[model samples]
Target: MEHEMRAEYEEGVEPGPDAEVKNWHMVRRDGIKAMCGRMLSESAATQPADRWGEPEGEPFCFLCGAVYLREVP
Candidate 1:
């Protein structure tokens, strides 16, 4: 799947930051907006659905290792 996906980008777009960025972005973005458009489209899709539900457990930042759980009121 990864190879095929890469081929699609290689043949369909220019070889530069835009293509690579979009390719990497799509890989990480998952199915959030694979069918609609570009990263901007994914950003727009995030607004309403961003708070659909609470995390069942604590969520951790992959980079800083910070943990966030549901804040109790």
Candidate 2:
């Protein structure tokens, strides 16, 4: 069975001009934990499944992507 992927944003306040930038992490569709085994907080922000890859200029979690590529078909 193939596991569905979901994107959840972890917002952080930076010191640069871009005060708030969202770093999206890939997680299993049915759970809040990311593919890299990081448990997302209850307040984490989520997007529609269609918008998973639409975050331009924002980086994805490398560990999550790596695990997804290796484990999810």
Candidate 3:
């Protein structure tokens, strides 16, 4: 099946030195919005190229992961 989902995260000034950084989210492959309902930035890079192997120690959106797993075939 053709994939309809991708990984995304916030990467810009909004997450400044003082601001808490947002977690990576699983999003629709065709759009910039995350499965957790958060709208990712247009500048946010997608997976593979981002090389974000399993969220692991990195901050990630649990909600997005839950939804993504449920949606997967």
Candidate 4:
């Protein structure tokens, strides 16, 4: 089954001076996996249960409580 992806602005941290704030768009399954992988790789600590499940499917961001998933284009 396919999934739905959603993103929201992180709190406190404003977009960088040169950062161009844009709407978060839906990406593919592989793309979502890659994105999550990169995020995990950057973090030194293990992801929380809310962010990373045992099987590593779509997870919600604890910081913003936003859910992430693969979205159909």
Candidate 5:
């Protein structure tokens, strides 16, 4: 199940000198778009590299330290 990621940038959300900083904004600037309870399944050999939409890199979940493999449904 692949999801098309979209980010809505807010003007004062980057912890600027203003007080109206929104918390979440496509926060996963990089890495998996959805967790799907399938965290850290990256190193598994069942899937090959050519299938990845993004070039392979060290993408890890910043909050939980999980790596996800892309498997579009």
Candidate 6:
């Protein structure tokens, strides 16, 4: 219940210039495709899904490198 409520209220914010990025979560590639109708998933190198170990902190678009952050707690 708590998780659902938190997720419902989650809003993305752009961190300040002085803020340091300690972690990152890649935005869903599928959602991007649906919204923009463009392919940001296919990688010239390793596929995004093929990557390992998700970090914490800022949420980012893996394809475009746009970062979004939400405060937890």
Candidate with top TM-score is: 3
Per-residue lDDT of model 5, residues 1-70, tens digit only: 2222222224533333342322111112233332433222121112232323432312322222223333
Report every candidate's CA lDDT.
Answer: 0.24, 0.55, 0.55, 0.30, 0.27, 0.27
Comparison by TM-score, 3 against 4, better one = 3
Candidates in descending lDDT order: 3, 2, 4, 6, 5, 1
lDDT of 1 by residue, 9-54 (tens): 3334554434432222122223432321322332221212122133
| Candidate 3 residue-wise lDDT, 1-73, digit = tens | 1223343434555533354445666666657777788887665544531333354314667787688668767
The alpha-carbon lDDT assigned to residue 17 of candidate 1 equals: 34
Model 4, position 24: C-alpha lDDT score: 33
Off by over 4 Å in 1: 1-8, 12-22, 26-36, 39-73
For residue 7, model 5's alpha carbon misses the true position, in angstroms, by 1.4
Please say which candidate is ahead in lDDT: 1 or 4. Answer: 4
Instruction: Report the lDDT of model 6 for residue 42.
Output: 27
| Candidate 2 accuracy as lDDT | 0.55
lDDT of 4 by residue, 3-70 (tens): 32333224433444442222232222323332333221111112232323323323344332233423
Query: What TM-score fits each model?
Result: 0.15, 0.54, 0.60, 0.19, 0.19, 0.20
Considering summed lDDT, which 10 consecutive residues are worst modelled in model 6? 1-10
| Model 3 lDDT-worst window of ten | 1-10
Instruction: Decide which is better by TM-score, 1 or 3.
Output: 3
Native-referenced Cα lDDT, model 6: 0.27
RMSD for all candidates, in order, please: 13.7, 5.5, 5.1, 11.0, 12.6, 13.6
Whose TM-score is higher: candidate 3's or candidate 6's? 3
